[model samples]
Target: MGTKPKTRFGVIFEGAKRELFSVRELDNGDLSIFFKAPPFYDFLDGRSEKTLEHRYSFHRSLNSTPPAITLMRTVALEGGQIIRTSQLRWRAGESFSTMVFARACPTLRPEHYIMKERPKDTVILLYPIDIGRTTLFYHVVVTDTSLDPVIFRRSGLWVTSETFGHFKLVVLSGFFLILPFHRGFVSHAMTSKMRVDGQEIGADLPPIDLGNVSPERLLIDIGRMTTLLAEGLAERHISYIREQRYAERFVTETRQLLSLRPVPTPPDLPRR
Candidate 1:
């Protein structure tokens, strides 16, 4: 709330990091944050795994001529999963249950209700982030007209403690349904602890040190964004509720009219 948070932007291409970026190396054979390629990987591991430590190998290749460091948040689960504000079905509006659901689904669903299947270039309107000095493309081309939703595992957000972001305009190419992507953060101190307990091999810079995460300064910004989104969702829910109530009221108001207007009789049919 007081001062601005520091941030920088970079794209992470999971697993394909070495295949995409030209990792930087120091004279002593250590990797620097800068790279000539995109990065892929999550930041906060689901169970605190070494998803980030292994990224050091991206620089070890020395020959990896395509990418940059990976900073992933929530990893994808088995099948298609997403964090979405849209409820697939009617909600009971139970308070406790809503909070529980929100806790599990922190991010919005990447399932975009976009175009009818076609080869087109779509843009990810990056909010709270600016891709400066990087060659990453904001436009994602959907080349396949008849294919499943393409998960761009090769590109991920360079999340930082000082930044918070959301893609206002989004698409996963072919299919709107995409795999689950959890978004969360890991404490720097906890990450250090992971290294000593026979884990976190090939130590290197923390994500903050790497300068990959891009976010707006001030934690308050994130809170504000969350509040705005919640309020918008609440308004929509209320509107739906009103629609349902209106229908119920209309039925009640017309019931007496229907009852008084009549019981039709089948007169004159006896002539037949």
Candidate 2:
């Protein structure tokens, strides 16, 4: 065993665990990852004819929601350290407008929130979570896990799970987590309180008033809250192990599996 050859591994989500993609480690030590969209996946609707790059554009043209999902996945893959994400709107005649939210963080920082607003287009929120921050989220109902595998589960009050680095989250039943609300944008929810787990982490936390805030601002605040928690969890464990590399050998080894894998071809989406 010369040098014990460094091996590449990836963590698969429960849904994508099936062979919907291929992973190749390149000779230059980067991975070439190819992902095929499965049938009935929302991203495939109406945009099947588009290439990967154009598909992003096509999806952005119709709805801003799908691309945000993509960005969130990308952020998670990058260990949840997201500085900014862009939202683009397609205007008539193929014209596009873009909004950029940016932030610069200093090293060894404490938890804080910063807001920058551009009345017409952009709104920037920067909230950085310190290391070892843990938040315990409360949910009112204890339903089955069918809602979303990435977030909720059916287990009778499971303790907590790790996502990225130091973002450790625990969900409790009969308790609802109250998220911030931006005025005139976000629909109201039966409000509840969310607390941090340890005294050293989330002591004397302020309450979130969902009554009168802008939608963009609320989004930034919630996003920052989530980012900080996920960062804390990422610090706790090594979750994202796969990096992009082109591996000729991996392609050869998994060729049969790739060949037999059924790529999803969803029916044409309904005309908008």
Candidate 3:
């Protein structure tokens, strides 16, 4: 029997105005693109300093915010064919200036077809749209699943702030996980005795807590870690807090600590 053949696809991008733009694929199968539009500072009509400060703080707190762009778009290709549903869109308002944002080529693994032994010819064209219109252009080529060549292309003008706040959360969570682990070498080992239908099937192994810690302390630490993890997951629409067993334990422990009652100290008694 013969093996099935792979498909191919094509794509193209055209900017309404000449601007900076780039595209990259994330680890989680999401495609991301970043671009900048003309500076819109002049359009800040009667904008208060407080409002500006708030905007700046929000952007700063979330390091994943991309620079302002007049317009941005991303398209995904599988086996050389563009997947329409995977298209992403963004656009900024008309107030920003025309300085093009810096273009970036973050590390991305192009789909396997792009790296095939006999890769198909692909072209990406980018240029200015017009003098008054600050637009960028893109052209991509791909091969379809039926081994037919097809083109996927689109163009648009820049729009307002397009922030990747959710991506930032993922990065923050990763940083948190690494920080404590880097501070000291801590190891957690778990042993579970298996039983069939409630019958004892094995002897209990000795408990070994690699880190010098008590149950209360361990639970507290775990709770804090889970809190951060939960925050990150929630930002990414991952309901691990409710679905994962460990995450549930962390939530329970954290709530317990927050609601803990005061413990009374025993009175000293004189001995005869």
RMSD of each: 23.6, 24.9, 29.1
lDDT of candidate 2 at residue 220, scale 0 to 100: 50
Model 2: per-residue Cα lDDT at residue 171 = 25
How would you encode candidate 3's per-residue C-alpha lDDT over 1-272 as one tens digit per residue?
53322221111212121222233333332323332211211112563221110000111111223322211221222223221111111121111111111111111122311222223322222211111111111111111122111111001112112123221100000111111110111112223343223343456755522222232343344344445443443343233345588466656655654464422222331111
Error of 3 at 51 (Å): 14
Deviation in angstroms for 54 in model 1?
20
What lDDT would candidate 3 get against the real structure? 0.23
In Å, residue 268's CA in model 1 sits off its true spot by 86
lDDT (Cα, tens digit) per residue for candidate 2, span 1-272:
32212111111122121121222333432222222222212222453222231011112122443221111111112222221122222221231211111111111111111111123322111111111111222121111122222232333222222121111112221111211111001111212221112112223434432133332343354345445444443333222223234234334434544454332222331111
Query: All models: lDDT?
Result: 0.23, 0.23, 0.23
Q: What's the lDDT for residue 84 in model 1?
A: 13
Give each model a TM-score: 0.19, 0.17, 0.17
In model 1, what is the error at residue 119, expressed in angstroms? Answer: 51
